[model samples]
Target: MAKMKLRVGVIGVGAIADEKHLPNWQELEAEGRVELIGVCDIVSERAHEMAAKYGARVVHTDYKKMLADDKYDIIDVCTQNRHHAPITIASLKAGAHVIVEKPMAMNSAECRAMIQAAETNKRKLMVAQFMRFEPDSEKLKEVIDAGRLGTIYSANATYLRRRGIPGWGKFHIAKESLGGPLIDIGVHVLDLAIWLMGCPKPIAASGKVYRMFGDREDLCNAEWGEPYDRKEFDVEDYASAYVRFERDITLTMEVSWAANIENERSGVSILGDKAGISTSPLGLYGYENRSLTTTRFDWLPPQSGHRMEIRHFTECVERNRPVRVKPEESLRVQQIIDAIYESSRTNAEVPIKAT
Candidate 1:
């Protein structure tokens, strides 16, 4: 018997779709594992361009029209943060498994709605927390799970850019992106660190967000994209937070798109009673025979996390297996994100009641 080919449809034809999702799906199609059925974007030209490149049979300016066809077996939602929930719920209700882009949605409420839709339709819904699928993350998880990082008590996640404010799309708008670097890039390291620590239930968060440098287009050290109107920048350029989790564990995180720093850097460090680990150099520190020791893995898997993430979702849908990045876990992450933003607003700690 031959394997069934998943008919895939992509809802967003933006940078993420073009860079991560489409390339992987195109490769899977070339391998005769799936079919690129259609591509949709509010911009018809972008949709048509992606469709032509990826061998998609149809192009749609509206996602609802594409969902009405009932030809897709898997729908990949790669739209902006605002559109994640609606498109995901619609896709799941349309009888297709879904893989949505990161930060889940604009808020925890939307994340819950997406989860409910997936449950009601009895379909798999996975978020694109691609960091979890990264080779280094996988190795770290293995070490932690093996009890090497005994009694994990705390973690510090930091992603800082000296002047890397994104100038594309609606990133500078709070309505579209919910928050800035915290939700945009901070979520990646935050999710990985929390996942490595076994997904502890978050209790509360206290944080501060700053909008200092994003509005200054005169800054000469941005990472990418052209200049945009400084007046349109309404989101935070930097965010710092401390989150308390169950089991007396804690996580401190810092992320920024624009900062008055010397250089850009990103990584996480987890501290345990018995052992500690840092991600950038993949180093392990512990006491061996009552002496301080350090270890490093010279052999790490050289795999593209985006490709692995897409392949994992496709295989789970094909085999009716559970997805790696569960909807509930993503909801927790969203809750933390929401609480952080709220904490920033009220200048007080916001409680996160476990679901």
Candidate 2:
């Protein structure tokens, strides 16, 4: 009959599982669907060098002993942000089907206990929000799901990196990346500006965070990697927020790794009464014949939003179908990053409670 394959497994072989989920799960294990078996890492030589560079027959430094030794259908967590809810709730109670990485945990009560351990183990819980698998965010989410961006509201998420303070790993260590650049790269442009405004339900947030230049010591990061310890730089190189969603939808965020910005900038811009979009030069702003138009994107297909977000979560777990990054929309982007870090620790305005 020739069907069954999907056995994959991986749990933090670092640097985003060596640059984006083990080279796209070794290209879906050379297209015979899947079967990387295992690879974990508390650096047992980076879990045997990423399980001998991704062929992955097995190697773990205890992800609860690789979930009590094998039996995965799929579990690629790329860990950090505090072991994404206890290794995705112990790999969904050891039955697998998880895809963490993102600001999906370390808040929102661990994203509601990793979505209640993937809904009491029915499994499938994705959240690698790779900017919604960007090709200019899937052409502005197909022109805002074809209503042409009408009635959306507002957005503006920016990611700045003028001094790029990521001197490799544990990103300035707020107990291992819980905050900084608003949960790293501000949870990727605030989860791509709240999934391009169609996921609205954030309720509230107002923020502030800054540490100037990564706890300085004559700072000059010299190209981001290996030079960390300025007393282990306690997080927050910059962050700013203002979110509110559900019907009246609004968002405004700014992230940074170190600022005084002028060099690296990131995008996300939405605002629709009828049209408005922007994701770094892939634009559209409207008023068609009443005359204030602007649309761009001369050509698009250059895909690799982390290899189409690990090939759309391995084709929605091989066609059981339904995971375009939803874990209740990453627990509403981790409840607006736990209400912008409890509104930057009680400066006020925090509300957000809508899992």
Candidate 3:
């Protein structure tokens, strides 16, 4: 006998849906574990294209209409940074669970509001901080759990790219897109490092921000495809932070859209009492393995970060198990991100109010 399939609706059929979420859920549908039902986008054409391409039964341009359409077991939100809170709250109030992308909301306050709604409504809210589902990251988690890294002391997580700003509109320098690479890319490293370190309470944080190659037509670091509003470009292109945890552990994070580095540094390396482990773009490190020490996945997973997270969410809904990445845990990531922004502005160490 087989189990019942979970009905899932995905909101925002944009690049992330077409590229990551839809394809991932499609694979789950193929495996007969979940039923892909609805897809919504602000642009009707995109919704239609995704529904047609993926065989979803329902499609809507308005998110409210989609939320009101049916009592879906899971609503996967793949929208921009600003829209996460409203849509998530509405879905929760409508009695449906939510799975949203990371930097959970525009700020820590929005994150708190969404969590409150979910708690009041008794619905599951899972933020897709997709890195936790990556094979390498999971392996690193296992390594730590096995106590191979014995009493991890410090870590450095980086998401540095050399002039590789995104080639989309507003994502580069638009605050309405909710800040720059710090929230856009830094959130992942911050969450990954903190999670790998047992989600320690971030006690204090200090950050530095710079706009080295920004605010000009000729100095635009991203692609020359979109007509950017030179006057409206007001976000930082580079951000770095230092964090101290309550457990006496510390972590350093560096993220950037455009930098002078030779290449990208997209990994987290934790130095422990016994050994050191590092991973990037692939599997985890088993620094204590006799033959495979200090080397994590030599090859990458065949799936994307969004895939693993979606699968975990769907399965958690099906089994009534806890969301692998809890809303509270994800909210902590947003909390740190907010602090980084504040610390950058004040040029002082900002204390994290929430544990």
Candidate 4:
């Protein structure tokens, strides 16, 4: 007479888990749609604390133990970039759908492996690309799908923080997080931009990275988080890339955790032959009646993209329908990231092999 509740487990009870993933999943638990079964983290105290706070039935320091201990219907992974692939693959093989944090994994190879595991397991896998769930993004996508912005050719994604390197986590450590803002905040805007542009196949990328202020000793880093050792900061704070896609489509991206700028600026702009659109002000620009005109939204629903993203994943899992953020699409984004890093290393354009 009643529906069964989906059991959910969460890995990596860190800041992102606490702030975004856990709170939203807990809300779903309250709605009787899902049960928070287990919370896992390397730090046992954090695991126990989140388990108690979120009404999870169990706590685990090791994710393997968590997978062995219970059969979860869904596993939300909020781990570091390097652990995304392994944890997600393991969770999928263990008979649970997975939703991992953005940037997917450390490299394209890992992304492909994760996708394969999901395919083999017949489970859903989704990336938490929260920006795509925003109201403005949804509206813009509708306009684009309707051919309002005809023949989309190029786009630009920019995310720059004046002096905002993470002072807290393993973000500055290259071995732990892969790279700096490119893989960090850069991935967010880049993924959103490409998704809005209809996800063209990226052919090649040319890029460069710079470790400007992150590794320095004399900079003010008090605003971000707790202070960390300067010697541990080895990743690039800034990255720039130009990516070429199929059908001559192109995208240029610039991201920095620290830079010399008037203020922090972040937005994605899509250019088309007929018209153009920008995300910051949610506006469209083009010529109307032989005169330039701009249409700006005076109001849009202010919904939390993270909450919407979590709900979307849960609904897709429940209905056994396709997820909004498909693994193949995320793999493409990972491919672009890999090419950019390789291009930076060789100081030449790197081709993105088809996967």
Candidate 5:
């Protein structure tokens, strides 16, 4: 006897789908492990185009209609931030495992709802936090889990781009994206750092946000390749936050889409009692015999983050195993994000309640 090929459907055939999700599904299809059954987008043309290119047999403008097909074993929700919760919840109720894009949802409340829906339907819900699948990130997780960086106490995660405001999508709109680079890009490093730290429970957050350069046409660069309305850009261009966890562990994060900095830079540094680890040049720093030293691996296995994420989700669904990026972990990430936004608005520290 042979196993039936897993049937997969993707909603939101936009940049992320075109660039990452669809391509990876095509690879899985080529390997005879899964079938791309349908592609859906509000834009009919985009959906049909992706279906034609990616071997999906059906195209739909509405995701609900696609879900009614009941042929799909997995649904990939690549929709906007606001739609993550509804689409995921609905997909789970429709009896399909879900893999939604990062940040989980606009707020923690929505994350809780999505989690409940998954539980009610007995379907797996996974957040597509691709950074966790990257080569350097995997190596760092291996080291940290091995107790190499003993008793991790604090971490700093920063991702900054001098003039990298996204030109496409509704990233600058508060309703669409929830925030600027903090929610957009900051979520990546923040989730990575938290996951690497064994997901300590976040107790509180203090943060601030600034709208320094997003709305300035003169400051925004065309390198992102889209003409966005300067007047419509109303989200923060920079954000900084400090979070405390249950075990007295702490994490600090800073991220920007447009900052008047020396250069674009991004990195994460985790400090433990014995040693510390950093990414993007990926090194370990510690004291050896009362002398400071650094350790750098000569090579790490090259893996596509997006591909690994898609493959992992599909395998989890097929094998009845747990997903790497669990929904509860994503909820924790969302809780921190919610606290940061609340702290920024109140001009005071906001306490996070772990549910």
Candidate 6:
């Protein structure tokens, strides 16, 4: 029997759709993997534009109406973080599987709601934590599994940019979108830590957010600051967190947009008793008897992210299997995020309660 093609509908034809998801799906369609069914955006012009460009037959401003009228098997939510839960729950209840853009939802409560909706509908719900599909990260996980990183102790990560802040549709620094680099770029790095630690349950967490990157709406100047305003800075441009995993593994996360750091190092390095490894540079640093040594070797591309993640989703939808980036797994990440937010608010450590 021949494989079935998933009829895919994309919500939000903005930067993420145009630059990543749609392109990958286009390639997949060219390879006979899936069919482009519909594209919807709150902005009808954007929907029409992507529809015309991607050969989608239907375009609509209201995603609910699109779901009602189209025969799409999968609904991909690429909207802002706050929109993730609503769209995903709607999609699942509409009898379609969903692929939500990362950060899952605005908070852990929303994440749990989405997870429950998926379960109730028996639909596949996935958080687009694309880093888990990266090859280098996959290899590093393997190294940890093989005990190369014996008795994993600590994990530290940094995701910093000189001044690159998002400027599209409340994505830059909207408090509703959860603000700052932490939920934006930092979510990926934090997810990397959680994934590398085998998605350990976080016990407690503490965090702080900074607003030094100016405002979040129009006024701030940079490549992506046209839609930003220095006066409306409601979210943190910098965020740091310390998470305690179940096995006593503590992960430290730092992310920033307008920091004093030189260059970007968006990676997580795990310090184990035997060795420490990191990606984005793929370095292994450890003790050799009396002397400490750091080794960097040329390895095969470890970060095949966007395309692979899209393909995996398509595969799961076609096979009727649950999504690889399980919704429950993402709930845990949201727990940490909620803890960070609560910690920042109360100026104290917050206990992480898993959903």
Clash counts for the predictions, in order: 0, 0, 2, 0, 0, 7
What lDDT score is found at residue 212 in candidate 3? 78
lDDT for 296 in candidate 5 is: 95
Candidate 1 residue lDDT tens string, 1-355: 9888999999989999999999999999999899999999999899989999888999999999999965789999998999999999999999999999997999998999999999999999999988899888999899999999789999999999988888778888889988899999998998989899999999999999998877765766445765677888889989999999999999999999988889889999999999999998788899988799999889987999999999999999888999989889989988999999999989999999979
Instruction: Give the higher-lDDT candidate: 2 or 6.
Output: 2
Off by over 4 Å in 2: 11-36, 43-57, 60-127, 130-143, 150-154, 158-169, 173-179, 182-187, 194-209, 212-230, 240-252, 255-269, 275-311, 316-355
lDDT per residue, candidate 3, 312-344, as tens digits? Answer: 888787778898887888887887887887888
Query: Mind giving the per-residue lDDT tens digits that candidate 2 earns over 104-146?
Result: 8777777888888898889898888887887888888888888
Best by lDDT: 4
Candidate 2, lDDT over the whole model: 0.83
On the 0 to 100 scale, the lDDT of residue 344 in model 5 is 92
Worst 10 residues of 5 by lDDT: 217-226
| Candidate 4 overall lDDT versus native | 0.92
Off by over 4 Å in 4: none
Cα shift from native, residue 287, model 5 (Å): 1.9
The CA-based lDDT of model 5 is what?
Answer: 0.90
lDDT of 4 at 336: 88
Clashing pairs in 6: 136-302, 215-230, 217-228, 217-229, 218-228, 218-229, 219-228
Worst 10 residues of 2 by lDDT: 219-228
Output the TM-score of candidate 5.
0.98
Q: What C-alpha lDDT, on a 0 to 100 scale, does residue 188 get in candidate 5? A: 96
Better of 4 and 5 by TM-score: 4
Instruction: Spell out the clash pairs found in candidate 3.
Output: 136-283, 136-284
- Give me the runs in candidate 1 sitting further than 4 Å from their true place: none
In order of appearance, the predictions have TM-scores of 0.98, 0.34, 0.91, 0.98, 0.98, 0.93
